[model samples]
Target: MRTALLLAAFLCGPALADRQSFPPVDEADRDPSLVEFRETLLAKIAARDVDTIVALACPDIYLSHGGDGGPEELRANLVLDPQTLSEEYREDADAMREQYWTDLENTLSQPGYFDDEGEFWMPHQWQITLPASLDAHLAYFVTGQNVSLRQQPNRDAPLITRISHEVVILRDHQSSAEYQRVLLTDGTQGYMHSDFLWPMTGHRAAFVKSDAGGWQLCTFVSGD
Candidate 1:
């Protein structure tokens, strides 16, 4: 009987795990200094105040997995020089630059948390850990409450269900599409609004306080 119960638990485990939810919790208020710092930094980002933004960054701010991260790279990314782009990408230079700024603003606007090290990271969902067996690249989080999962990729389509803060698998993402196709863990496939789904590997930012008691932008990056 014990062996049979163990097998039953094993068989039921995946479904139980699939129903797990990660709700957003913002611990930013735990530190008043971080609140002030983030507010100022967000305003600077909004105004595209390069000088202020650069100054707020740590000397060795991390921007990517293999990027040579620092103030210079941050400036270049924000400035978006057309000449720096390859011939093919130059035509879309303006849009690309705008996207950088928009992404930064949106990322910073999300709720955040303070780690054990006291460093603050934004988009509270970033802290969710996926199972090792799941492919991180294909996983996404529904960052909305009572979000519609439609039968088709349109607003008028039939509603399959409503997903809250849950993990879903996305095989392909069309950047220009208003809705994204996703598969729930229970094998229910449907469409969700693109805006409600945040790629598990999406951009997130971190703020760390220096010994001098001032916060700095320590990391702003995406991907695994």
Candidate 2:
């Protein structure tokens, strides 16, 4: 029995260690200045005040992994002029622009934390560091408590477990499907509602304090 127990522990130890939960915490209120700045920026974004929004960004804001990230690129991305696209793709220009705006607004609205450099990063989950061996594209965070892990893709399926603020491996994600197939770190496989799963590579933004003691949008990009 002792030998059997030891073997079991050895088999499960690494998997258990890989399972970690990173709950969201909002630290924006820690700095009154940041809180006020964020509120004003959010309002401007909602109103699509292009000039004011561009003015709030750093002179060389980082908007993507590869690109000349400056106010010009930011403006182009925000405006998404249909005239610039091929005639075939022009019909969806409005949707593309709206998506970019929505992504920015939603990301900033999420709870955020202050990094070591004193920069504030949003959507709280952006701070999580996954195991290097894990495939980043396959990992997702459960954003809710007692979120059901169903035995099948449908709600009426048997309950496998309830996950809360934990990392789960996604086997597959269908954008139109309501439930996503997922695998728990313990080797249990199930389906979870799509709404509660946030991809680790999802959009995240950062705000930095300028030399004049004002906050500016510094980074707003997604992916690894």
Provide TM-scores for the models: 0.90, 0.89
Give all candidate RMSDs, comma-separated. Answer: 5.4, 6.0
lDDT value, candidate 1, whole model: 0.84
- What is the number of backbone collisions in each predicted candidate, taken in the order shown? 0, 0
lDDT of 1 by residue, 18-135 (tens): 4546788888889888889889999998888999999999999999898899999999999989999999999999999999999899998899887778888988877777655566
| Alpha-carbon local distance difference test for all models | 0.84, 0.84
Residue 102 displacement (Å), model 2: 1.0
